[model samples]
Target: MSSQASLRPAVVLSLVLVVWALTGLTHAQPKASVLDFSASLGNLLPSLSRPANSSRIFYGVMFDAGSTGTRIHVYTFIQKDPEELPVLDNEMFHSIKPGLSAYADMPEMGGYTVRQLLKVAKKTVPRLEWKRTPLVLKATAGLRLLPSEKSQALLEQVQDVFDESPFFVPDDSVSIMNGTNEGILAWVTVNFLTGHLYAETRETVGILDLGGGSTQITFLPKSKKTIGSSPDDYIARIDMFNSTYELYTHRTCIKYLLCHVIHRPPYIIVLLYTPGLEWRVFKSSCLPKKFREEWSFGGLTYIVSGKPDGESYVGYKLCYQEVLKVVKDIVHQPYELKDTSVFYAFSYYFDRAVDAGLIDRTQGGMLEVRDFKKRAKEVCNKMSKYRPINPFLCMDMTYITCLLKDGFGFKENTVLQLTKKVNNVETSWALGATFNHFQNLKIHR
Candidate 1:
């Protein structure tokens, strides 16, 4: 037989494998509109030649439009069989600075920014599979802080871009996620990636997500006091993978810790702008005695500094008092938090820990709550030296220390695992959101 004729059978076999892998079943139904020609070849194959589908691979692209930056997570997943959940094979991640919220005034520019990131996805997903890949963008506290009209404009612009792209876009492709869902999804991502979801013991770690405009604390309450004492809105029920989790979620203001505190409200601060007062400054004991600078957040700039006339004591004690005002009386202490429950801190939590040199940036380590207090004192007292490295380090550290002790009511010796990634996947809500999208689309089935 000729070489060309012999190669034809191998090509036919390869086509059959591709079809089986895409469809996931030997008895095919109507071809899904999302799949292209190659995925619909199952009907042409002879019944005797059909083989059981062993493994199938798919892709999902999720964009995390955060306060500080925009990140793209292109996830590759593999399924061993039709009845099983897809396993995360690998992730292609990239980021750009100054978040989408930065373009509130110029929304088209924000769309262009998203377009730039989509190039990464285009390069990562195969050309033949582009039409089937799902594209989604979920904005966090940064965009949530914007005026309703402004945020909607940004989302509309992003939707326009998604409409133009070759990838599959759902009806609710781009939107700002509420704080409660954000916390729950992060918890899901951590527990799922950590193998705690399928564990027989039902032990799961809590998540502390500190962001630019706000912060979230989510965990499964071991004690009845935590559930009974919490406000009705603070508890949320999440149904996933045939299990229901009654999670306790708390959304608090952390923006003042990052930017400037405008007014001394109870738990949250209402941001206001004065037209002609550039010299007006917000004072905080958490800052160095002589520190004065201009800081910005949520598209507004504020002058903030330490009190120049106060007593010459600037350390953890005073800084903790200043930070305490932001969290005390506002945050409820969960009964289980005082015990040995492990907590994973991320976002600004991980960043501040690394900035204070309490943990390594690459290989994160475990540290007790007292460790943050110790480091806060050192950073606050030695501000002259570390100021150039990060002017806000002292305030940030003090706030974190205060947030843990007085805010969330963690014990002094309570351990916190600081990490930015788990199993090479980002410790963010993006992964869980991607999984949710896949489930909603029924792509796995």
Candidate 2:
């Protein structure tokens, strides 16, 4: 009987221990479930899902074949995640003068120029990333002015060079950019670099680009009058980054209207024509009354003079009238320009501002439209003395002033930020075009 009682006590203690362990485990199950739910919730958030270092870093190579020079931009970018836009980390820029157009007759020479630039790209971009980095060459007004066959020959040569390179090349890698597309891309570049593209407030700026063969003006028109008054071809709708933008674009010979007059009506009608050095002397009232010299543009040289007969009219008032004819009725004035909208003028605009001492060469500054007018008057009146400095200063200044005040119809006090670069990157269309190319390919992912 004593042995049986002892065995019963041991069995009862064992059952109690088993019950206690089961109860503890059931209570702990809810805690384990909560921990797993919290982890999944964290993963649903982009920031918590992956760290910044988890993003892939890549590179891009872009060549800007402009009228005066050819430049290469090697860019490094980082994508935080497959769903995010790539961030531009840095850029390596280099250029060579006497652009690809200089080699129009000798296509091989043009290819050689591109080949040399590829070396720079090869050195700048990581060797391991070469196959992933896209190489693109975009020719601007320089090639646009060339004969179609000649332009094609040059582009073909560039394509051959690109094919030989180790970098990635797209099918439409080498081509001439239309003036309208050029302006729009430039606008995107400036806005994107300025952080205006992603701002919560959605602020954006206008862009003015003056090239050797053509000039462009682009801005988002807030006023209905601007859209209504503009011609059908002047307005363009661009879809980017899940947003649509209506932009106003205009192209013309900077400060002068080219072409012989066909007819004279309320406005002069003329077909756009390209003038060559064969016509030795070109006259303009914007030139100094006593100045005459040899000037070159777009691979053509011309003996430009004030007048063949006598001293040319050199005054802001006279120059304004001459320049006004080029843009008066053709360019639609934006109503919101009177008070709103900021403009970033670059290329020839920036160069001219620097030459006129209006802004620093490296660190650019802002100026009012009136500032250009004031400088134009001073330069035009003193042309006889300043001719040695820069024979075209008077003409260039007057043209910029008239283009802004009479051509585009900005108020005198309206501000214009003149810069060649924003943050370290050049404010050119190449960067934006690079972004467009990669986005189209979905390479960021």
Candidate 3:
């Protein structure tokens, strides 16, 4: 709410990050211990800061306060000549575990994580550019799921840390980003990297980003009926690359089963795999009945298990039925999905597909809606075979299938391009968000 202004600016996507060095792994990335990971990230810098006099190079630091983890992205921009527009030059990325929400009761601890990631930014950016460089952080599902008082406490702590740092901290530098913006920013990043943003042709692909805390669907609706028949708020008008885009976008909750129970404050997520979740046990059909383990996420731990000795048999049918209730009637189905549209699904979508051998981990591939259904059936039927990889793989796959088909109402044959990154940068909202911040765009409703 800090940067919500009436005046808006034209977003030039051409100047966004051209290539950023990013790291990617499976559902969980770089399984390094928290101690070693923090050490590695902090010690990567050759010097405290590089001294440079030329103003041709610009730096921006963006911290992604995600539900699963906290990551820092340092982006460098260069303009060869004063008349020419700036383009991306270089970037560095790193992350730490247990998102900000995990420290709901201990806001200072959350600030410590931000402080640690800030060190990476200092080492990445030049000393001369520190004062001019913008440092900002936007939180996603994790903090959004916490109690208002608790989430606000966490943000305030982060703001304090940002102010103490040498980098420039603009108004609303640390805040919880709405899900709709998350989806739209991602649309910008993907379209630009995929050649749709700057191309003469206006053809752009739809995007589906399913994170642990929230899920988003955004696309340029081709059919008039879609815009006319849908809810008024689902339609958003924005300017990008000097063109106006009336995109059909919606932000839906998909944090395990917590999406529906959002009205209950002091929120809690279901079926998350994290550390220190040993207090309570959660049972779901998504896992094998005989399976039992400790799952952790958002700073809390819970004992998770499939139905015990007396529970009914667990398989695709049962798992789908259980996860279906979480999305039924709650998610809106836009018209014209079967024709004239292509979609790119990433985040949890790509991770689960990789776990099921449905796509290559390195180079993502395409798949029909039914491919998920088929894989979900195979994995759920033989949980033993896939359980070694991830105990919740069957449930997660089933959830994706249900979300695409029943939730968003996509046709079974609808083609979805699954990828983790495009053009060397991670396929995320960070780049698009950075563009919005670098230009100081207002957050308009």
Most accurate candidate by TM-score? 1
What is the C-alpha local distance difference test score of each model? 0.70, 0.68, 0.72
Order of models, best lDDT first? 3, 1, 2
Clashing pairs in 1: none
Where does candidate 2 have its weakest 10-residue lDDT segment? 1-10
What's the residue-level lDDT of 433 in candidate 1? 84
TM-score for each of the candidates: 0.79, 0.77, 0.75
For candidate 2, write residues 142-191 as lDDT tens digits: 78878899999999999999988887676678889877788888888888
Q: Tell me how far the alpha carbon of residue 432 in candidate 2 is from the true structure, in angstroms, after superposition.
A: 0.9
In order of TM-score, best first, we have: 1, 2, 3
